[model samples]
Target: MSASDIRAEARRVLGICDACGYCNGFCDLFEAARRRSALTDADLAHLANLCHACRNCFQACQYAPPHVFAVNVPRTLARMRHQSYLDHVWPQTFAPLLNHPVATVIGVTLGAILLLFALVLAFAPAGGGLAIETGATAGAFYRVLPWTLMVGLGVLPLGWSALAIGLGWRRYWGLTRPRRATTGEARRRWCAWRTTLADILNLRNLRGGGVGCNDLDARFSPWRRWLHQTLLGGLGLSFAATLAATFYHHGLGLQAPYPLLSPPVLLGTLGGIALMIASLGLGWLEWRTAPEPIASESRRLDQAFLGLLLAVAGSGLALLLWRATPAMASLLVVHLGTVLAFFMLLPYSKFVHAGYRAIALRCESLDPVSID
Candidate 1:
């Protein structure tokens, strides 16, 4: 459907939902909807982000399929949420990547790996073995891939991704941020920030009206919530590990190949294991989920994001295991390539949902009715 049709459909469904009021207690989205007499594109986008796709309302909906109304809130909002991502995307040129995310992700990953392989073949010493076996010395990693080259590879993509995501966040805020003037605006915003952070950290909405997400079947299950928490936690730890490594390298004048007991190594190891498990589990859940409640268009994008996480986590763990072996150099190249692709595509992929959702949650908390 065209963008206008999608918005029109969403408005129709939400209008019915507002009149019914059966789902007001299901999620914060319903409350937000109740307050809106008419939904603009911006309001629809905000509501889309507010929905966690828990499918609770879908299951409880009496006007669902087989009925004349055929109200399918989850599916409609899912499409709208995706459209919002495209609408607010930074640089505008990258929006097309969202249309074929899986292909884009795979192509970028393979291209990076191939380029890394070519660089290795062209630059490594003539007699260096397949492993490019740099001894387990302080600067062994740099021996295979120079520190300068590694820094360039990591920094450039990450810097661009940050800029893109930041700009997109700004645009979304401009579109959906609450405009009502109120007394104690600063205090209310501070409270909203705190409430939103707590909600995001715990994924309060995924609880599906105090039970759990109806992820795979009609039955409520905590599996989705657990997997989401694990993924978010794992990513957090992994980022923390990177920051720790940076501190050790630049602040303390220490090099990598840090001891197993060191903060970076320990954090990264735990994070990698969690990421692998969560990525695999989430993929399985997605595969088994009932198709009726999801946006068909988003399946590829979801899978592509999960695949990138799995590749990064799996390759990093493999590199750590085989760092001293003949496979170390090959694994290193694959790991770095996957990381590069992940960062480069992050802003254009499902990863942007986290930022958008956080903003939505904060906006919801800012509503007068939401305050305790």
Candidate 2:
């Protein structure tokens, strides 16, 4: 559907919901909706992001599917959430990538891999074959891909993605946040930040009014919430591992290929395993989930982003396992390529939902009437 159509549909569904008020206790989205007699485009955007797609309302909704009203809150909000990503993505030139996620992700990843291969072949020392065996020594990774070149390759794209994400977040906030300051706006915002952070860390809304999300059918399940927590935990550990590696390199003069028991290696290994498991599980859940609660158009985007996560984690683990072999150079290139592709696609992918949702949660928290 076109952008206008989506907004119009969202307005219609939310208007029905606001009038019904039956699902008000299900989530903050409803509470926020209660405060608005008529939802504006900005209000719809905020409500869309605030929805966690828990499917509780869809299952409980009296006017759902066979009824005349045919209210499907989860699916409607899912589509709107996806649209919000497209609408707010920075550097509008890349916005189209979000539409064809599978193609964009696969094409970008392959391009990065090929580019890395070309760079390796061109920069390798004279008389060396395509494969350079750099043993299991410290700093061996640098032999295949120089430290400076590798850092540059990783940093440039990452920096650009960060800037893009920050700008996109700013745009979303500008649209959703209150235009005028209240008497105690600063204090209210501070409280909202803390509340939103707690909600994010715990995947609070996924609880679906205490039972859990309706993942597969009408039955409430905690699997989705657990998988999300695992994914976030794995990402945290992986980031921590990176930080530790940096400290070891710059602070202690230690280098790459730390021992299995070392902080970086141990933490990265665990994180990689957790990421692989969570990504695979979440992908499976998405595939097996009932069609009613899902936005069919969003499957490709969700799967594409999950595939990238799996690729990065799996490749990193493989590189660690084979660092001593002649395959290390190729594996390093693959791992780095996947990492580069992930960073480049992140701002334009389903990842943006996290930032947008956080903002929505904060906005909900700042509402004058408590949702508790």
Candidate 3:
């Protein structure tokens, strides 16, 4: 019915969460934290970045809690993603990125170019003037074509994300209070930017990671956790590499034809593949083994989000298959469309959790600090 009702239902009924480390073994965030010395608020925040939103924990935690809680970890995480819009985080840094509109816009635009830069380089020689023309040498096309992409596809979305952060940071939209907004909206609006950002990014409040603060208790399958983390970590690495390669090749004038097979290139390629595979794999697991069905009100949106992902991955695979330079550009065009649609619609879509979970966790971090 109302939002609070939904949250209550989630923590009490729908969420099959147990405070088990079963999911820990499989979770990448957890793995990264473990690999390091002590898990900090920064560490928890990083964990949020890598979560796959797969409900494998739901299936695995069946017997841990006596009653199923209604809390949706994924959804909450999505809400916390608002923190990212407020401040642009690279997801892995876990540390705070002082909110910067220029950096946000530039970083994302560069990322888009970087993603397809390699293909562009491969086509550059074909275009003759280091600019990829339609039917030029693969080198010409590879180097030049990405500019068309960077110009035609990349700039708009990056510009928007930067705009949202810039505008939203100033409280333009946030100031327009909801008529009958609930406490949640109030908290979201009035919450101190830094504190809330920390909480949302850190995800210290989440009960699942282990703690008696919240009722959520569940054991998750290690296999699913690993799959989710591997994909997330890999993708984050891929994104970073994309930026590095672009700077090296474009800015420094080095010969780095990308989007082809090599060590790191192969790894980036593998990361994208892992994302698709993991998405499908976890989707299958959810269909086969969810603890309970989501409310009908939420089901359609949920399915739509899932369907979009399937399309993103499917389109990507199609591009890889048709990598015959000419087709690669078109395939890239399709990717830009889907991904842009995906990011722009984040707030309204089920994907919002991708942003929010860590902030909640960060709030959790403050409690212990106060207790001591």
Candidate 1: tens digits of C-alpha lDDT, residues 1-372: 889999999999999999999989878899888787668888899999999999999999999998899899999999999899889898998899998998999999999988877877766655442456664456666656777788898999999999999999999988888777666778877888899999998899999899999989899999988999999989999999999999999999888778878999899999999999999999999999999889877877889999999999999999888787778778888998999899899899989999999999987888733221
lDDT of candidates 1 onward, in order: 0.88, 0.86, 0.44
lDDT of 3 by residue, 250-318 (tens): 786654344465443565566567767766765665455443422332344444555555556566567
Q: Each candidate: RMSD to true structure?
A: 2.3, 2.2, 12.5
TM-score of each: 0.95, 0.95, 0.51
- Candidate 2 achieves a global lDDT of 0.86
Tens-place lDDT per residue, model 2, 242-341, is 9999999999999897888999999999999999989999999999999987887677888999999999999999988888898888898899999999
Work out how many backbone clashes candidate 1 has. 0
Which residue pairs collide in model 1, if any?
none
**Worst window of 10 by summed lDDT in candidate 3:** 363-372
- Return the lDDT, model 1, position 75: 94
User: Which residue pairs in model 2 clash with each other?
Assistant: none
lDDT ranking from best candidate downward: 1, 2, 3
lDDT of 1 at 215: 87
